[model samples]
Target: MSCTETGAALHVEGLCWGPRPGLTLVDDIGFSIEAGSRLAILGPNGAGRTSLLRCLYRAVQPNAGRIAIDGVDLWSVSAREAAKTIAVVLQEMPGDFPFSVRDVVMMGRIPRREGLSGWSELDRERVAHALSHLDLAHLAGRQFATLSGGEKQRVLIARALAQEPRIIILDEPTNHLDIRHQLEILDLLRTLKLTIVSTLHDINLAAEFATDVAIITEGRLTAFGSPDAVLSPRELSAAFGVTATVHGAAASGGTRFSFSLPRQGSLS
Candidate 1:
């Protein structure tokens, strides 16, 4: 499957979500993801990142605000149509599935599937190509459960790529993977000219991988700009309760941030 060479615009305005009549988990949030650009949403745990992501991916409906994809309101888009355009590689990986690598990755082809048929030669080729990109071609027949955490992460990413999506939404894409795999995934994302919106735990990684950083604290956006402009020492201390120092990475041409010792009980 392929998308029109059109740019995918992910626009969100005044988006809000939560349960019951009160206690808003996310409130009056607004953001935009332009064509072929990447935005890394950064926040501490339970800072409404997951709630915001759920709204973005239509996992949950927002009580207020507009989320549009290429001028189409996200709520109006059919689930099947949304599946073809936006694919998510969520933070939580699926378990207890006794499927082979090929079988799992082939699920990406579900959008194009008609009723209850099987994979065609083209489908197999697409799966193979996806595996090859992640260097998992040889493990096509291997059990997904037997693979390492890093390998499973890559397989999940491959599945997302197999969808040929115009926009990719990831929730902490580097969570359980080792340093090497983390860098590899970020490197791949840097080269892909598709619109990407993701939640990230590592502020340093976001500094390197993201074209723009959106910092959220207590369910509100605090800062949004280029890494150097947004991830300041002051913001770092307040946002994550850390004293961070940013430095240049000569090899990747990206900035690296290091944290200093915290005061006994407070940030000074």
Candidate 2:
């Protein structure tokens, strides 16, 4: 994704939302992301990481705030126009009927296509490129429903890649997967060179793969900065109420995060 370093590749200002009493789920939260930077949103469940993403994606409306891409307000354009730049991959890829892996990914092209010309040569080129980039070429002809958890996750990510979106939002992209596939997916994300914002359950993975990490606590953004700066022992313990240790990744020659046994309190 091409962008200017004017503060961030994506920007959010005064973003807040909730229902019923409509409590401020994300209170006055704001940040900027540079182009080609990766940010990992880390917190315990219900910390509002996903809610913040929904607001950015224009899925659920914020009670008040301005969300901008490059510098334009997202609400100023129609949903289709917004979609032309944003793509998302959630824990589950939602669809009712059967869809070929290739077909589902090609659907990403619809946003960029002009009227009824069908899939153009350029579109096919993009699909093939995304498949290869994602290492999903072998599964291109497979049915989406028949794939395992890890394969399905990668396919969803490939579909997002096919969109050529400027900003990619992934919520728990590694919900169910073996250790090897988990590392593979994380490594792939590290090399994408796009403006990526994702919510990850594994604090270690967040630290390892992200250039910057944000710690959201009780509906507010509590910490934001480089992994070494933010994911310290005190901060990790306070945020998740767990014991954790940060060290070198050993194999990758980078930060490696590990959890220590909790002394007390409910396991978060």
Q: Model 2: per-residue lDDT, tens digit, 1-268?
A: 2322112378888888886465777777888877778889999888989988889888988888888887888898888777767888887666453999899889888878899888999889989988999889999999988887777878888888787787788998877778888898888877686788899998777777888888999888898888878988888888987787777654475766677669666455
Candidate 2: which stretches are off by over 4 Å? 1-8, 94-97, 247-254, 260-268
Location of the lowest summed lDDT over 10 successive residues in candidate 2: 1-10
lDDT of 1 by residue, 1-268 (tens): 2464344888889988887677888888887767887899998898999889888888988999999988888888788888888889998887777999988899998986778888878778878888998889999899999988888888888887777788888999899888998998888777666788899988878877887789888888888878778888789878988777767753567667888777788775
Indicate which candidate wins on TM-score. 1
Clashing pairs in 2: 9-33, 247-256
Question: For model 1, what is the error of residue 6's alpha carbon versus the real structure, in angstroms, after optimal superposition?
Answer: 7.0
| Model 1 regions more than 4 Å off | 5-7, 248-254, 261-268
RMSD of each: 2.5, 3.4
TM-score of each prediction? 0.91, 0.89
